[model samples]
Target: MNTVKIGWIGLGKMGIPMSQHLVKAGYPLNVYNRSKDKEDAFKAQGIGSAASPAELIQHTDVVFVMVSDDKAIDDIFTGENGLLKPEVSGRVIINMSTVSPAISKEMAAKCIAQGNHYLDAPVSGSVKQAEDAALVIMVGGDATAFEQVKPILEKLGKLAMLVGDTGAGNTAKLAINTLLGIVAQGLAETVTLARQNGIDAEALTTLLNNSALGSPLIKIKGEAIVNNNFNAAFALKYIAKDLRLAKDMGADTPLAQTAYKTYQDAEAALGEEDIIAVIKHLG
Candidate 1:
């Protein structure tokens, strides 16, 4: 196979290792980051650097964006020095960012108008899973483009599923995050209550991991909370962002109203720390 020339935008906690994994696997990569310090790790990996989005667009056949939110994606694609404004062709932009479904749809249409393909390939996993290539990816948009990129995507994720048409990935990811918040709230609240009553948090986590109701999420995230590791496997800010997206989509689910309020309280208490920091609020 000809090495796929990839334009990797965003070099945060997840994006850094994801791009590094691709580089380690011998993919031709050109990386761009709004923050220079974050790019330092990749720079040591012999990845090419682009000072601007347009410069980055010049060097690749595909653009893999693992950014913050809709605004960050919009800025890269349609900002003053937007990638879309450059003279480019034969490109596919796979956004692994968990953005709003509405924004994903709009960006996909924009890519089509510019004669490029787009995929809303939002992911399920944190920075740790991302580094380990253990993420469950949720993708939506053109099937042909997805097929063409499946090899690369597989290298980055363990379970890459096609959910539906344009915007479906973001929609699914947001829905997942909403429920994840609720589950985290329940887990944290329960563990804190137990700990307060003299139950060992670690023992409870191990017990739950072996129980029918246990999941990989609770096992790993619960362990983090038990250890008081506030390292950003996933941040409260990102979860809060997804909760807001869920609230917009939850017109049919009034119960989601309650979860959103809980996330709001937790975020305020924790100052937008890691997902495990929600347990701090509970404690």
Candidate 2:
């Protein structure tokens, strides 16, 4: 099979490594980032760079976007230098951002109307999983389009599941993030309670990791909390955003609402820190 030409927009924490994976897989890749420094870095690595989304779409069969939020998504598709030009016809645009399901469906409709394919393929992983290409991708769009892009997605993730028609991927993503936020809050509160009662935080984490409650996230983020390492693997601000999206989805999300409040306070103080930094809010 011929290698599919790939174009990528957004070179944030996850996007950088994802695009690098495509380049490593020997696919012809072109990249565009709003930041010139990131675009220049891609150029240094011998990957091509485009001035705009429209420019990027012209050169590739598939375009992957991993922007920040719904507003950023809107800007990329409808901005002056957007990708919805006439030449985008027949191209596949896979949006891997975590946005509202409503926006995903609307964008999918627009892309289809313009004779292009759209996939709302949000991912489940942090910086480590992204770097290791171990993400679980939930994809929603045309089944044929999903099949066509499976190989490409596999280069960036361990598993890619086509959940349903357009917007389902984002719906699934929001659900997963809701659980993640709740778990993170639970872990944070547990750690704080332990620390306050004179128990060693790291020992508590070790105990948890050895217990039935242990999980990859608990072990990893629990360790981060114990060590007080608040680096941005998945920033608190982003998770707060996801929580808000989940709340707005019209579900009876009391637990998620509580977690949302916790994250919101954490984000106010340590927005740029990792989601694990929510523990800091307990003090």
Candidate 3:
């Protein structure tokens, strides 16, 4: 069993299952979530809970954060009773949240100055991939620190690669999510076009699945579109947020711009729904 004491600071849809892998791997883990119910849930499962991020870091060597956006990232690491508050040193703080590269760089600098290592290690894949430990993690930070926690990261994802320096993971994530928006929008428009021209949703999806252009995302989102199941696996709003972040990072291509606007327009109505629900906005 890897003996690095672990601390996890988020317990949302993705965070819960991702952290579970650590506990199951016997990493001597402790968790801290803003919601007491989630902490209680982990505690009930024989995992440990801490009252705050500061408290959690006191006893752990490696801390993983998987919150929502940049604001949440700010609050988690620098808010009241945050991780950097306790005068701790040598702790590897890995942020796996989908956030802006700028914020990740800011946090990395702060953590490094305080003698802690910070890695922007955001992941690609949704709740299902997280549950299955099949996520593709893109990491950025100190090489030594990455090698130190590689094994723990492996327990959470099928592939974990260090893409570059401090904010590179978030950069890669934004780029990937920008493509995700473009692809999802394309899929939504294709299904809409086929359905309008007398091709049944299932029939078109089947053809697409067998075609050379097919992919796991196309297959899965195609099924969701066929069944009209708009329930979120990856919420449309998050993708919209990512697109905006990408725009800020200079993703100014025609497809990127169009997809950003498409998702933004859909945000008001279908934002809470699955990203594939962009199809609904078409009508």
In model 2, where do residues sit more than 4 Å from their true spots?
none
Q: lDDT tens digits, residues 186-231, model 2?
A: 9989988888899988899999999999999999998888677999
lDDT of 1 by residue, 1-283 (tens): 3488998998888898888778877889888999888777677867678898888888899999988988998999888787888857679999999999888888888888988889999888887788899889999998898899988898898988888899999988988888888888888888988888999899899889999979988888888877788877788878878888888876336557766776677777674577768877766
Give lDDT tens digits, candidate 3, residues 1-283. Answer: 7688999999999999999999889888899988888888887878888988989999999999988899988888898898889979999999999999899889989998999999999999999999999999999899999998999999999999999999999999999999999999999899899989999889999999999989999999999988889999999999999999999999999999999999999999999999999998985
Q: List pairs with backbone clashes in candidate 2.
A: none
The superposed Cα distance between candidate 1 and the true structure at residue 205, in angstroms, equals 2.0
For every model shown, the clashing-pair count is: 0, 0, 0
Residue 75 CA error for candidate 2 (Å)? 0.6
lDDT of 1 at 166: 92
lDDT of model 2 at residue 100? 94
Off by over 4 Å in 3: none
Predict model 3's lDDT versus the native. Answer: 0.92
Clashing pairs in 3: none
